[model samples]
Target: MNKTKNIAVLGGDARYLEMVKNMSKSDDIHIELVGFDQLNQGFTGAKQIDLDDLELSKLDAVILPIPGTDGLGYIETVFSDKNLQVTKEWFKKLSKHCLVFSGIANDYLINSVNEAGLSLIPLMERNDVAIYNSIPTVEGTIMIAIQNTDFTIHSSNVIVLGLGRVGMSVASKFAGLGADVHVGSRSKEDIARATEMGVTAFHMNELSAYTSQCNILINTVPALVVTNDVIKTMQSNALIIDLASKPGGTDFDYAEKRGIKALHSLGLPGIVAPKTAGEILGTVVEQIMYEQDLGEE
Candidate 1:
C-alpha cells in the first residue's frame, strides 16, 4: 500500500488554476489549493481551502506560482480578491523535509527558505523548462512586434541580443518571418551557431554600430547590455522589447527620451498561453514528485 502525496499550492494566476486541474487528475496526488475561490472551475481531486486550514506539517511539497513571491513576500493570485502573504512565519510552519518549488525566487524567498533549512527548486532555472518556455515567449514577442510596429516583419531589420534559449528562439522566429535577423552574443560559439542559422552575428561590443539599422531590438540578457549609447544609436521609430525580468536590460529613460517605444515584457508564457504554460509546469512537477516517490521507495 502506498500513501498519497500531499501538496499545497499557493496563490497564482490562471496558469496555476490550469496546473492544479491537470495535476489533480492523478489519484496518487492530493492537492490543497489556497486563494482560488473566485474561479468557477474546480479540480476533481483538489480541495480549495483557506490558508489557515492548511496543514503545513502534512505537506510533502509546497508549490508556488511561477512569479513566486513579490520582493515583499506577497504571492500574486489573480483569482482571489484577498491578499496572500507567504512570509517567513508561514515557511516556519512547514515540515523541514518538505520541498519548495517555484519558477523564480526573490532575495527574500531565498533567504527565508535557507533559514528554514528547506530545499527550494527554481523551475525557471531548469534547462528543460526554460527551453520549452521559449516557444511561447517567442510567439508573444512576435505578436508584440507586429502590434507595435507600422511595418511588416517581412523585411524588418531585427537585432536579438544574447544567444540564450529565448534569444535563439526570437532570432529564428524573426528570420523565419523573412526579417533580416542579427544576433549579438558574448560567446564565440553562440556567434558561430547564429551564423549557421543564416543570420548575421556580432559580438556584444558592436551593439552600438548595429543599433542604428535595427527596426526591432529584442533583448534576452538580464544585464545592462542596451545602454544609453546603444539606445542613442537606435532609430527614433525602433521598437525595443526587453524580454528580461524586472528592470530589464534596456535604458528605458533614454529610449523614452529618444522617442523610441520600449516595452518590458515579462512572464510571456502565462500571459499569452496559460494552458500550455500550465501543462509545461504541471508535467515538470509531476515528474519531480514521481522521482521523489521512487527515492522514498
Candidate 2:
C-alpha cells in the first residue's frame, strides 16, 4: 500500500531547486515543478507550469518557501516568470485535503489554510527538522558574530536570549570558543539545562540586570523580548543580532537612534550557507514524504 506522492513545488529559490533534485532522486516522489521557467536556467527535467493558472485541486501536496507568508497570505516565488501571489481565496480552494508544508508558516497563513480547511505544517516547527536545522542556524550565528565584530569570540561576554535550539547552540558554540556565554530563558528546566552546560543562565526575570555588560547580544526569542528600556543598559557599540521571525526582539528604531548596531538577521540558511542549508531542508522534506506515504495506508 505504498502510495506515490506528487509534489507541486511553487516559487522557491535554490533551496527549492535542491529539494526538487533530492525529491526526483528519491524513488517515493513524483514532483510536478510549477514555475521553473522563471528560475535561473539550471534545474534539469523539471516541467514548468504557469503558477498563476495553477489548479489547487490537482496536487497531493504543496510545498512553499520558508517564512511561508508574511502574515498576508502572499507567497514569494523566486521560480516564477511573474510575481506569484497566493491569496486567501486560493487557500480556500486548496482546503480540499491537501497537506501544505513550508519551513516557517505564520498566523495569517495558518488562518487562511484553516479557513480553507486545508492542513498546513511548518517545517521549522517540526521537532526533528527544526533541531537538526538549528545546527546551520547556530553556525550562521557564530559566523556573523565573527564577521561583524572586531573582537574575538574567546573571552567576549555573549548574551543569548531564549534557550531554544538556536539559542542553546549559539551559547554552546560561543562557550566552546572560550567566550563567557549567558542564556536568557523562561523555564526552570531550560535554565537548569543551560547551567548544566557550564554557562551562566537566567530566567527572563533576571535578563535586565545582567544583559548590559555583554559584548555580543544574540536574541532568539520570537517576540519583542528586547525593548528600549533594556537597550539603555547595553553599551553603545554592542552588536545586537535578532534572529526572530518578524518585528524581532530588538527595538531597531531605538537602537539606531541610540547609535547601537542592531540587526534583524533572517534567511541565514540561504544567505550565509545555501548548500548546507539546502541539504538540511532536503532531509526534512524526505521525512515528511516518508511519513506521508505511511499515512496513505
Candidate 3:
C-alpha cells in the first residue's frame, strides 16, 4: 500500500474550505486538517486536530491562506475564537523535511523561513497563474459595477488604470460589452495592443484631463497613481473601483468628502469565484510538488 502524504491546512475563508475539498480528492494525500472541522462534518476519512494539540513538525507540508500569514506572523483563521495565530516562529518548530506554501510572501516571513532553512513557495506570484486568476477578477468587477450602477454598460465611458494582467482582462471585458474603454498605461506595446483591441489608450501625458469624462474608473495599478489631483477631476457620480492591494490607489478621504463613491475591491477572485481560485492553487501546488520530487530524484 502506498503511504499518503500528510498536509496541514491553517485558517482561511470559504476559498480555503473549497481547497480542502479539492485536496481530499487526491488519492496520494492525507490531510490533518485544522480550522475547518464543522465544514468537513459530512466528509469521512480525514482526521481532525485541535488548535493546540497537533504537532506541526510531523507534517510533510503546511498550506496557508492567500495573502499568507501577514507581517505580524499572525494567521487569519475563521475558527478557534478567531484568535489562534500561526507565525514564522511557530513554523520554525516544524520538521526540516516539511515544506511551506502560501498565496503570497512578506518580509518577516521570508526572514524567518530563511533563518530556519525552510523552503517557502508563493502560489500567486506566478504570472501564468495570476493571468488565469484575472479572468474571474474581470467577471467579478463587472458584476459589482452592474449591481451598484443604475445605468447600463452600453456606451458608458470607462477608464482603466494600468494594463497588467487584471487591467488587460478588465479592459477587454468592459470593451466586449459595448462600453467605450480608455486604458492608462506606460508601455507603448500595451497601448498599441489596446488600440488594436478597439479601445482608446492613453499614456501618462495629461491623464487628469481625461478623468472628468469617465463614468467609471478601475485601477489595477498597485501604486498610488491616482492622487488627489486626479480624484478632484472625477464626476460626482463616477464610480472608482480600485482592484489593487490594501490601502489602494485612490484618495478615499477626498472621494467621501466629495460624495463620490469609491470602492476598494481586493481579493475579488477569491470572494466571487472561489472554486475556480482553489482549483488554480491546487493545480499549481501539485505542479510545484511534482517538480520538487523530480529534483529530489
In lDDT terms, which candidate is top?
1
Per-model CA lDDT versus the true structure: 0.90, 0.79, 0.81
Summing lDDT over every window of 10 consecutive residues in candidate 3, give the lowest-scoring window. Answer: 37-46
After the best TM-score superposition of candidate 3, give how far the Cα of residue 285 lies from its true spot, in angstroms: 1.5
TM-score of each: 0.94, 0.88, 0.92
The residue-by-residue lDDT of candidate 1 on 1-297, one tens digit each, is: 056889999888878877888988988889998888887887889989988889999988999887899887898887888788888988888998788999898898998899888989999999989999999999999999999999999999999999999999999999999999999999999999999999999999989999888999999999999999999988899999999987799989988999999999999999999998899988998888777778878
Q: Pairing residues by index, what is the TM-score of model 3?
A: 0.92
Please give, for residues 160-255, the per-residue lDDT of candidate 3 as tens digits.
999888999999999999999999988899899889888999995667988998889999888787778898998898899999987898888888
Q: List the residue pairs that clash in candidate 2.
A: none
Sort by TM-score, best first.
1, 3, 2
Off by over 4 Å in 2: 40-45, 52-58, 69-74, 86-97, 106-108
Summarize candidate 2's per-residue lDDT along 21-102 as a digit string, tens digits: 7667766566776656756555443566776666677666888887686766666766564656678887777637578888
In terms of TM-score, the best-performing candidate is 1
